[model samples]
Target: MDTTQTGLPVRRGPRPRATTTNPHVQLDQNAPAELQDRLRDHALSLPGVRRGVSTVSVPGTVAFFLDTPTERPAVPDILGGEWGHIHPHTDGSLHLHVPSTLADDLIAAGWAEYHSLVSRGILPPIVIMLYGPRDEAELAVCSSIVEEAYLAAGGSRVDRAGRTLGLPTP
Candidate 1:
């Protein structure tokens, strides 16, 4: 191992590929292909959101995570999400975060439920793993949920995606 400028040891071997246990390997969530494409397209179009690349990403999962520099949020509050993001997996389910109010509302409406693993360590309690957008209409609802999460993460959705757009001048 060699120490890098950041004072972390670096491995000097062929890098390994991403791996996953994939508990849902046999469970396809039944969302259509178009919906999956739409979700990916929309997420990349949002400001400061991008295709996720991490040390550990689940195999066969398409993730769009927030890339904005933001202040961490205080729970029971909705104004900011420190690192909000979403993963629309092959199983047709969703894993994401939204402000607590929206999360509660989604749970009430039967659109989603909490992922018990969120708070063990990986994500904050405010982040929940959503389940089931089993159809087109449900996918639309899913889009809105994603929009809210992205917004909470301090992302904007102008056509430029990641660029800052100046106000029109006189």
Candidate 2:
């Protein structure tokens, strides 16, 4: 397994190819249905997150957004509500707005690539598509990545175990 400079291990095998990142779909190496379900469940389970149909993504994509206002939402305007969403296609990939530095790291680590809109200057580079987890280990890594997105949203600080340390007192 190839690990990133930050120690996030990239999944084994060829990097999944993208047929069109604008619609944000993958061409091959899609995760199986079970893994896809598990990944989506894990992402939706993050603190302050809620699931709904994506207003920003392609039709049928399930969206994850902060249900409550964050103390300091970093990218609060993502499609007016969503901060991330899971694609409905077979690849099961997801697009999310994370911290810019982390986004660069994720791309460098081969875990993700910038959204097509970023290239055209329509969206900031913070938007990325984290490839779907291919197995158990990748699932864990992807979960961690989602947690980072949660943090970037100013949801709350959390431990590596995903426990809320407590929200800041207003």
Candidate 3:
């Protein structure tokens, strides 16, 4: 795992694999239902965030979107203000749009990977698959990651640990 002084710590294990077709689910190392609920609640609690079905993911996932988006979003052209979504009771993985630079760091740190469509140019590089949190410690990191994604989506909130990320301009 790699680290950047002011970025997310390297997640503690190998990257999890995600399916390549419809549904695009995580294949292993899923989070428990309780932790998934906690993470969902945390994302929804961000300022201006709202819960809804994902516009870009399979049905049954819960998505987080801003009620009002910033003028310039880090990832543009998302449907219905959608910024991120979680596979709650299923794989528990999440899909989000983050600042491009942060997406690279997240991959380098083993916390996430670019969404498959990004490589095919169907999606921008900002779109990523954030791996699920398997324990309390991992949940803390996942939560912070989700917050960063939220900020990138035009929502405002203070940094959790005084850790300033390269947040997308609002």
lDDT per residue, candidate 3, 18-126, as tens digits?
A: 8886567888888898999999998887767788988777768998878786444666746668888998577899999898988988888888988878878888899
- Per-prediction backbone clash count: 1, 0, 0
Residue-by-residue lDDT tens digits, candidate 1, 1-72: 343343222223332221122231214344566676676676667666666542223565656656453434
**Candidate number of the best lDDT:** 3
Better of 1 and 3 by lDDT: 3
After superposition, which runs of candidate 2 have C-alpha atoms over 4 Å from their true positions? 159-170
Model 3 bad stretches (over 4 Å): 70-72, 159-170
Task: In angstroms, give how far residue 115 of model 1 lies from its true place.
Answer: 1.4
Q: Considering every candidate listed, which one attains the maximal TM-score? A: 3
Cα-based lDDT for every prediction = 0.50, 0.76, 0.80
Measured on C-alpha atoms, candidate 3 has an lDDT of 0.80
Ranking by lDDT: 3, 2, 1
The TM-score between candidate 2 and the true structure equals 0.85
